[model samples]
Target: MAERKPIESWLTDMDGVLIHEGTPIPGADAFIKRLRESGKPFLVLTNNSIYTPRDLQARLSRMGLDVPVDNIWTSALATAKFLDDQRPGGTAYVIGEAGLTTALHDIGYVLTDHEPDYVVLGETRTYSFEAMTKAVRLINGGARFICTNPDETGPSTEGPLPATGAVAALITKATGKKPYFAGKPNPLMMRTGLNAIGAHSETSAMIGDRMDTDVLAGLEAGMQTFLVLTGLTTVEDTEQFPYRPTRTVDSIADLVDLV
Candidate 1:
């Protein structure tokens, strides 16, 4: 135990951290309401950057959640921030969705045709052979590889789909280069959310359901972490990873007592 600090602000992971598949986990909605009632600030951070804040709001609303747009954060946004910081005037050749394109554009990066300076990889419901070939070609040339996250798969009602990590692997096989991931376990993602929300690192907590990316990222970012078992991570999985989280609970329902 790393002496869990007195918590204040909150940065929570979506998908598993806040809800499962699409429904609010057990008591997730009530947890958010409690936070609102207590006047505590929290942001819903997610590695799934296929959708923007607005898109997420609509989707979550369909699932009976009452989250607002401003309180959402995504790895797509973080990837954009990373590229903006590293290369100020590079054209981006992306293989993600509209939200990713929008994020990069918002960060002042130009979308290009060929031989772009950067290749930003994200989740795509429709990854075609042509898209893969283009990405491989760009990486084979001189473009830097940037990924939203390295998750090989994401959870779903049916199962997991090939996540950005699978795409990164293909590019690596083609170009023999690893992409810079901008999601959890990468301190940049935490910095992006915390900075955006103007939250102090010490007072903030990263609440998630996965151990590898979410909890590890929180520890690396110097934030208290809470891991819920409702997602991909398991207690047995923790036995393998050496980095322990601040605490583990069944679901967001337990947050009522801790936070």
Candidate 2:
């Protein structure tokens, strides 16, 4: 086979690479502004499937950062896309909120309160036994399983909240079946985002705080990876990472030179 060409588009991580705890990393806005001014395209990709692009835009604007809705893509959106590709006419039993549902609908997947062709697991504040039972029944009936992410917990200013992976694990335990995940570390989420935006792997890159999720996904996607120290990954954790990033910076400001 011919050697693959380099990436010509940029794919960036959201939480730690650009913002943390709803706060913009120092110079993140300016870095994006520069990219915008330079006519460079970069998508703000997040593993959080709880919100739509509009939701993320609103939240970022609240932090005094402005981002177009189309420039943002969530792992939930990618998961929905992946499922749609797998089973176009199938109905999905979702364990997430409106964002995930919106993504599924946008991708032409039917949402069913009854027996579904697929079971989708994600982060939710209103998880119910009813939903869990539905998922279990679906799995037992040979329905496909897909999860939005695998992050065990999400870092918050207060601490960590049970992430999608935690809830996914619960269902996994009940069903004794491993669910397919579509977020960082899996690479498919980043690949979906790249394909959606028509970004090339050679020019694309993932910048984030977590080594396991953000960086690993980039590596798997054959894109450059940059690690920032604003979130979960600490200095010591870097030493333990099985894979290292192409670059490491203290903050987004430190990466102002890259974009």
Candidate 3:
């Protein structure tokens, strides 16, 4: 009935949409390549806060995708930005690996467990009960609570493992303070990604695999959303959600021609 708006830029979820279990999905690399060649601004959005952009780039390079480090946006980075904007040069008691720590450090945040301004939770391979206990006490003692993502579990070679959200829940139960999540499903993360790429929401498309995180975040950010049935979601799964994606495809392969 009307002319379709051209997508001038894009934001894509990394784990499910582009790769799965440490492997690139078929046609994902080509899709990224096409975006690169076309000079369209795009960003790879990830909720995984375990790795830095350089580490992610190396991993993607091994999978034959040549995404530059700057093209990758992570929840850790968004969390750091949020902290910096809220409290410049603030102190934090962080529970994560190099990715989260590095981002905070880059923004001039001091990491401390001694009466810190915030208790920032992030994804990690090892979830120590001792550290979690410390976090609970700190929040009880009046530190603000923040989290990188709300994913209750993360996929691994073995199986799904408890993630930041699960741990945050434990802390919340102990202290009765819910964390402010900084990852997908939060429109702030999507807006931060768009700001990083200098892209407009109206002409941008967000490609994701999950209806809850990717689609919701994209829609909240005022961008068109596309769901790819490559990982967690299926055609039937969409019905479970109250909202629907602007488009759905079997895989990224099906959308290559549109590039």
Candidate 4:
């Protein structure tokens, strides 16, 4: 093993690392404050593409967590970036909310159902049978498939709800085409976030709760990865994975001093 570069920039998951169940986790405020005071570029990342960054910023503000809109990144943004790079000003038949649609429109993508260049799938509370049928038909008609993230389920007050991955699976069964996932565990999301902040992966760090997505993405992207126990993965749970994060802390509070 070699000596790693100092962590100069940070990327962290939003739900698990910063907050839980719509509430701000303890020490989350202090962590954000320190990052801002240090003048280091940082981004709060999330796979949820239901709400735009502005909506998320306002929600976080209510929780007393000061996160700027620009400092937040979402799977929606990543998917849009990927599409723009692949086919600039292209047309798509989208099945998602404002977060995903706004991103595509911002990149000059036209949303249509008639022989689009791609059938873009994303996170949405309501999955309409009609819309999905249209997407399947478009994909069958030769449109390339793209998805924001591969998360099979999303958290909710009641329980886990079927997310983009699950819905994408349904569409795949119907169309016989696998959509390209643009978010975490793919490393493209990490790279896009790093590029947005003008940060180098070698000198950056990623803080996330899940070993499957967060830690895996960071490790593959050549950044130091920290697993916080405040969310999904546990100490015992870490042992089950074939790979491990660079370090594991009790919570976000433990990372404040490093910032």
Which candidate comes out best when scored by lDDT? Answer: 4
Candidate 3 per-residue lDDT over residues 59-175, each given as its tens digit: 999999899999999999999999999999999999999999999999999999999999999999988999999999999998999999999988999999999899999999999
| lDDT per residue as tens, model 4, 1-259 | 9999889999999998899999999999999999999999999999999999999999999999999999999999999999999999999999999999999999999999988999999999999999999999899989999999999999898988999999999999998999899999889999999999999999999999999999999999999999999887899999999999999999999999998
Question: Which lDDT value does model 3 have at 133?
Answer: 96
By lDDT rank, best first, the candidates go 4, 3, 1, 2
lDDT string, candidate 1, 1-259, tens digits: 4565577888888888677767778788887777777676778988887898899988888877778888888999889888888887679899989779989988888898578998889988788889888988888888888899989987767887888899789889988989989988798899888888788788999888888888999999999889999888889988899889888988888888655
TM-score of each: 0.95, 0.93, 0.98, 0.98
For model 2, how does the per-residue alpha-carbon lDDT over 1-259 read when each residue is reduced to its tens digit?
3554444566777787788787788888887887677676778988888888899999998987777898898888888778878888679888897789898888888888576888888777777888888788888888878898898888777888888888788888988999999877887888778887777777787788888888888898888888888877887888996678887888888866666
Q: Give, for candidate 1, the lowest lDDT window spanning 10 residues.
A: 1-10
For model 3, the local distance difference test gives: 0.93
Clashing pairs in 4: none
Give the Cα lDDT of each candidate: 0.85, 0.82, 0.93, 0.95
lDDT for 133 (candidate 2) = 83
- The residue pairs found clashing in candidate 2 are 6-202, 7-202, 7-203
Off by over 4 Å in 1: 1-4
lDDT at position 216, candidate 3: 98
- What RMSD value applies to candidate 1? 1.5
Model 2 Cα displacement at 48 (Å)? 0.6
